[model samples]
Target chain A: MSDHKFTRRIFLSGAVVTVTALSLTGCTEPKTQLVKIEQAGAFFNPDDLTLLNDIAEIMIPRTGTPGAADAQVAAVIDAMMMTWANGATRDLFSNTLQKIELMAETLKGKPYSSLTLKQRQSLISEIDVRAFSDEVPDYAEGYKRLKDLIFRVFYSSEAANADYVPIPGQYRGNLTLDEYESLTEAYSYGG
Target chain B: MADEFDVIVVGSGVTGGWAAKEFCEKGFKTLVLERGRHLDHPDPEYTDMLAPWEAENAGLMPESFEDAGRYSMLRKKGRLYKSQWARFFVDDKEYPYSFPKDRPFMWTRGYQLGGRSITWGRQSYRWSAKDFEANAKDGNGVPWPIGYDDLAPWYDYVEAFAGISGAKDDVETLPNGDFLKPWEMSCAEQFVSDNLKKNRPDRPMVIGRCANLSEVRPIHTELGRGPCQARNMCKQGCSFGAYFCSLSSTLPAAERTGNLTIVTDAIVTSVLYDDKKGRATGVSVVDRKTKCLRKYKAKVVFLCASALGSVQVMLNSRSDARPKGIANSSGLLGCYIMDHFGGAGATGVVPGFEDRYSFGRRPTGIYMPSFRHEKADDVDFVRGYGYQGGGSTRPRTSHTGKKVGIGAAVKEHVGKALPWRMRLIMYGEMLPYIDNRASLHPVKTDDWGMPLLHIDAYGRDNEKKMLVQAAKDAEDILIAGGCINVKSSHVNPENHIELGSRTHEMGGACMGSDPKNSVLNKWCQAHDVPNLFVTDGASMSSCSTQNPSLTYMALTARATDHAAKLLKEGVL
Candidate 1:
């Protein structure tokens, strides 16, 4: 109940901000503009953000469900980078992504954007296999982290198309199968 | 305002909070002084308000040796990670102490109005008659002046007030409390409990007796506290006031009395001893920020600045009446230190509970009471040990090898529940030795300019023996409880000598009948100075096999009541 109220307020205030911004500008000069979802973190640099967004779009392409890029997963991850990563972690994450991008280009035998859809998917799947292995190869460790982060961000984003309720009253110690199935479950591992 | 009050409670943690509440409610103008920052009933510093994804640290502190080397013991435990709530943990560089070279003591200090109470494992258990009698029977440490009978009433009082969550067990070792409501055991845990009951009746496994209120009573509602939401993010400071931390419970109650005055950032240096009156007048406090000195007078004083922290105060105070320090007549002030002997146990899979799992975190575990010399087949060790562990089913996520599955197979495996595993950690009693003591550091000084505590403590032969016995017994118990793939035992050379890492440090100003051997009396008061008290972990004469905070709260309440009565009777 309260979750809906808070989200509604957020949407209202967001709309107000957009209106105020548009009114203040008054002139449409659509040139040399850089777009960003969250400008708070180390990953907010446009180059890194664009690369992460492209990687996410390839991983979770729009089918029936909203894609990773559609949910702004990269922007969220970028914001989280500031809170989560120290210098060492930040370097590890960025360096690993760069290595993966190079590997993917080499595997496809072409630049990322110019590659066929099948070739791009094939490269992702190949990386996914190495990433999901029992003991991740030292080379695959960065891609593994990147893949895990993608899934984590995607599930927690608006793309999941799930409802939320704050203060989930009195946790049930024992829930029958029927009761669980009967209820409209909106599961989240807390944003 | 007035610098004088009827009672002055130093170190507003568990005991200090209780002291304030008890004294204030009794119509005594009580001043509760906290050395750290102020915190109110509704915690503003809680990480529970932040979602896990929102907090990139996942409401935990990541392992960072660079954060402060002092948290070396805790940093590995992902639960203690850096986030909004890690602020509760003191930065070790600012407040450093020295321990023995061989023995690495991990002293985690929670420096806030609530102190370590905010971060403590809420496991609340009453020490049984066996626990109280062990020291006296074994002839290791000084005999407890008061026993379970003396403390039974106070335990009931604190349990009711604190709103303990536990089931009534007719068992002798683990006595039941006046619990509001008991948290239910998981299917796997229940299986283990039932199996233990049927096969090994001597080993009773029950739901952990904890201070988190399973159900709220009107009294708790009056104190602006509610029931445990079972979110299990309590270490972040319970935003709901569900757990009985000093901030959520006692301090708030003290505030409600309108007779309580709380002064935060007041680092108490020493007790101001009076020569003529043979009493403690008040305390000398330095401003935590400005480093300015100030004095406050009270008819009675309670020292609840933790175990070693209180000892620093006693050793710092210098007076003509008792030259060594206030009430240090015997020169036995910083002696006979004790902590729960840990670092030995067992872990294994209870294969039968494969079909069972639990929902929502219990935030507590099963407690196996001490076997010691109680049974017919007794161990060679003097004191006993108890196993505090839990049996839970979690998704099978441990996979590490050169060859492994990928894609859908790995995803499916990572998302499913693994077999139930029973992990147990044995806590044996550490026998007190006079050599294992904490005194003032010779030259080193903290930010407050007070002498840093030099804790020279080590595990002895008896503790090593206890660990060995505990390991063997834990293995036996696990196998008997129908466990498979058992790692026979978990005793190690490094953990055996873990000095103060358990953070259950007790003694120094221990309570005893004889003033020659101990610092405090039966009422937890200074043997020489009646008006002064040390009701925190410092007053523990013997280290029992359970968590000691519940005992500390009871002792604080009992001492304040006694002091109030004595003050009314016109006694010094």
Candidate 2:
């Protein structure tokens, strides 16, 4: 089994340590670190990063192959939010996190952080079905969007395939219908 | 003192990059001017590594940016911020143009050193001999000043460096290029191509000739680029110079020569003409960063600033000798704008073949070369259209709105994902009509104060007719290949080019044999100004259905060599 732990500490130590430190320091020290802050604005917070990982794990939890969380989709999401997303999007992300937390409190009578893995998994499954069926009207759309983002990030990510998905080596231009069908199916299912 | 060079190539785009490389290689001091900010090649910015989910709006275009209307054209085309890599490509405040109420011109573009070449669909195909002679043979637009023979060698040269990966299709309508090893087709695509070839022999489908290097040749390896690792993340800009964009290929070569000097954030306002010498002496520019005016002199000038952009510059270059414009002696400087009519084709699903899978993401599709104006045996339209499309298995999105969360249901759904056979798209050719021209608007200017191009181009009757027929043909072929749920979509005949959809926008300052009918002479040199050349798509007399960058590169190389020889022999 692959270690799918995507802790904030690990992320901070890896690609974004300097950016994270600069941003945190900038908030404390005002005038001198303005430029650094402006540049560091293109970095995500540790909590949001962890939330992204949790969301990916919830969306595409590991089965036979490596799942979204294992790919460090949270880190990928964090990088994208900082660099590409605009203001309203950041607000939406915050709202989504808040909503997820609220849902956990309502369902399990505890914060998502305090829930065990099994409890967390149960809550995620319940929320997903409710969102899919349009039973939870308030959080449905946001949850769906979040689910799609997680899947898209994972499916298109390098970590989604691992050894499970069959990546075609050479193109063969004269295959039978059956041969083509099998190949396309493997591609869709991530092998 | 104002910096003087042997040549000043405006716009480091497809043609400009080629001109810079050729001139620099020829040992001429060349300065490439770009209005956008300078972006270094290879690892210019690290944003390319980002994934779509990482995006704030989940790769959606920001409402604020859309409201500003700066990238209205780009946004309309569905190219949203999947990553930070695409953010720098558009400025949401400046660069505005308006189309007529009913006519929506999606002028999708990027203005970095490499221009839109970074985001371009690198589908490279050589124009057939028939395409070169079409204008004259059919009495459409002006006849091409030069033909396939003139461009053949340059095509070979550019192909060698660009590293096009494709199979040699001996179809006369779509000539084969000097190619590297072709990328493998998806199994579905292979089935379709074989079936289409057998069932419809007239339409021969082959792998799309693209600039993505499947195998790194010595020339490409020298440029610090490696072979494509089959990562389909091309539109975001390849970090590996595995593809041929100006940033990846030509501009880098020019940089190595040391004679190349690139001045970004400087927009060329107008070409300064010397009436006595009958040539362009220099160019006046507006610094985009500071709004300051600057002038740069050169012995020769190459207007490689895209199709409409070059035409705008030429039309703005008015002198006392020619009050209309510098190269408007023929009154055809800013006329006959043409873009290939895209988005007409059929898509369907193929059943079975659930076991065999493939590896690596192929960035391109199978190409069905044009069969329409081959022998001219009872063809309705004068010109022809070609097919560029591919196959893919239906992804999880196909089950969108059908399934719910990430559980057993999702797993079962993913396991049983349907095999979507292929989608065939026919990019039809639009003939050049005299009325479909671009000119200066009465009262509008870009950020640099140059008059905006009032483009009034649209596909004519013949083009519309061709698209309709091509759509029908696409449907028939898909149906014959055992594709289910085959459906055809007709391209909107009006504004089908979508202003800048193809980005192969051609013909404003067109090339022709007669100076009375065309702006540029046979060598792509301006008829009025011998030293000034427009070697971009503006030099194209007619629009062929194929992607135009390869042709533009070939023309630029030929023109560059011609200009160098002329300069060396004191012809200039």
Candidate 3:
């Protein structure tokens, strides 16, 4: 598949696709939908999809709510990389994933896909901490971009967030936190 | 033989809709011509109901499409081009206008049946008395033929029909209209407004008066219009008919009268004037798709094709009787170009609103009315500006702020909302300058063989100075109102501001008391051609900081009333 331009049909349901096999021990069952990863498109291979799926789950692991993987964040990112993102954004996303693989090899002496669940969690946690610190690393900015996209897509999805109301009938300017939280669904506006 | 009607309204926008409605209701056969393709009410193209994830690329256009030169003007504004609503804007490559290489003017346009009203920022306000008298007092332009009093009842007339929602705030400069119940401000906004009232009472921040229906009335519901759902996605076109647009409100009302006829893809090239009768005979039109030339005869014509659009038509209508253009007796048909200049603002975090959140989107925010009614030592400009912005609770996620947290902790953090961040963007009045003008390009022509409009206008020293003061004042006001990390942004040092970027282009065919200096008189009737009227933004004497569409509607209502009366009396 080319890095740019995937007709909606080819991107959504066509091409060699697989549901991410989250077989890691102690991993929670994906309560929402499974992420459909294409074989290759905009800098992702089959192995890279596995690594990304694991990373997304570790970042927003299911508790009482659905996690990033559950929300099909990886699938959305793949589509965005091909269609929505520019060359710069695609490059950053690719570079960030490559850096994660290099770090796994450097620290754990193995590929990120081959690492144990505990090892993957510890390494990603360390990277996340270092990404936001004062002494910025080379991988910091790119990693943040990837992480931001994951969180953005996950939160915006109906699978992850139940508060996405399409048409809010009224506007109340100062609803108290207690009153807001008591509602089944929350209200929001603007980007 | 040409298609005959009592009235021909060119451009089915805000003003055109009002013009058609009034004339049709008054028992006149009105024909409305639109240059763009027809779009029905509750247009299927509206993406308002789509959720973020459901929308294409999550409400983002492809980077390649956005980078195209056609949307370069849209990129400067930064909101429309990147969003799903980008389709509403014209592709500049297809319908082009030019300006000086050094002086760029962003003429943001939406040329469908509803025109730019589909994508208009619906903050409607009536221009104050101070606004009318400022031009004459400051000697920037000619005196306004009509004042606030002349347009007051007309404002009431339009507001009652349009269903404006606003507070009757006692700010004389920003007059209150006959309104529906007002939208409320957020906790942080109220806190800042209350603080400002204590500190600077003269500059009290009040709820923005807007066209969104807070409560649907009989007048609105009679035409299938409903109350605003507060989606805040009005630019995508409201299927609810909640917020006002020509397709939703006025055109439907006009259609109900059975005296209205609409023809889309009919581009009016020029007004056809009769030398012997000394009046406009009809209009020359070209089919947008087929390039088929045609004529339409009418007893009267109202040019509501925006400021630049109407002026371009008049400037192209050259003849032996009036070679300067149709209503060129004043020789000011395409002069005195103006738009509200705004590239200044302040934004900061409101410290104590974390415990409060708003439900749904209010279509508009609070406005700080212009305080500089007259000259002062502190004020460096002849006219003033207003702020149209509000506070919103910032979204919290794993990557918010300095930290990009991981694991279950990140999800919990994302669940809670962050403190409110308030933004205040200032839009200042642009003084009418005869030097800042638009004319037909001698060499260039569009596919339809109409001359491309050549605009030569930019923000001046006065506008730049106003922005500087506006930024400083915004920072000061926010800091005094307990906002943290206040930062101000102003115009670029090299290029002060983009004139037409705000989409408030006004004063190309200005109204004035003296027939020698203006194209249109008080009734928006052309001085040379009594049967022709230019009632859109082109007829504006001055560009006020307040949104101009409301005034355009009021003027159209008022002008058509006069035209229908004259027609009845056999004055033509």
lDDT of candidate 2 over A1-191, digit per residue (tens):
12222222111101222132121211211321111111222345545544555656656766776666556565555655654456776677767777888888998998776676667778888877887773666777666766676676676555653333233433444455476556556653345
Candidate 2 stretches greater than 4 Å from native = A1-147, A150-191, B46-63, B79-81, B374-380, B392-406, B415-417, B491-497
Top candidate on lDDT is 3
Classified by CAPRI criteria, candidate 3 counts as: acceptable
Candidate 2, residues B1-572, lDDT tens digits: the string is 34898999999887899999999999999999998877887653534455433333345443555545556665555654433445445653477655666655555556778887787788888887888988888888999878888888889999999899998878877777779987777667767777877887777778788988888889999999888756566776777887888998999999999899999998998998887788888899999889999899999999998888888888888866676787888988778888887768988886565554544467788788777765365556777888888774333233232357575356445644456567888777788887777877779887778777777777667777777778888888888776888988886665444556666788988898888999898899998888999999899998888899999999999999999999999998
Backbone collision tally, model 3: 0
Better of 2 and 3 by TM-score: 3
The TM-score values for the models, in the order shown, are 0.86, 0.82, 0.89
Model 1 has a DockQ score of 0.16
On the 0 to 100 scale, the lDDT of residue A71 in model 3 is 71
In terms of lDDT, model 2 sits at: 0.73
Candidate 1 residue spans exceeding 4 A from truth: A1-47, A53-73, A105-107, A116-168, A171-174, A180-191, B60-73, B319-324, B352-357, B373-378, B392-409, B494-496
In candidate 2, residue A105 scores what lDDT?
97
RMSD in angstroms between candidate 3 and the native structure over all alpha carbons: 5.0
* Residues forming the 10-long window of minimal summed lDDT in candidate 1 chain A: A1-10
User: What TM-score did chain B of candidate 1 earn?
Assistant: 0.95
Tens digits of lDDT, candidate 3, A1-191: 11212223111211222233222222322432223244554446655665677788788887888777667666667767776787888888778888999999998898775666778888999999888889799999988878877777677676665666567788777888677654425444321
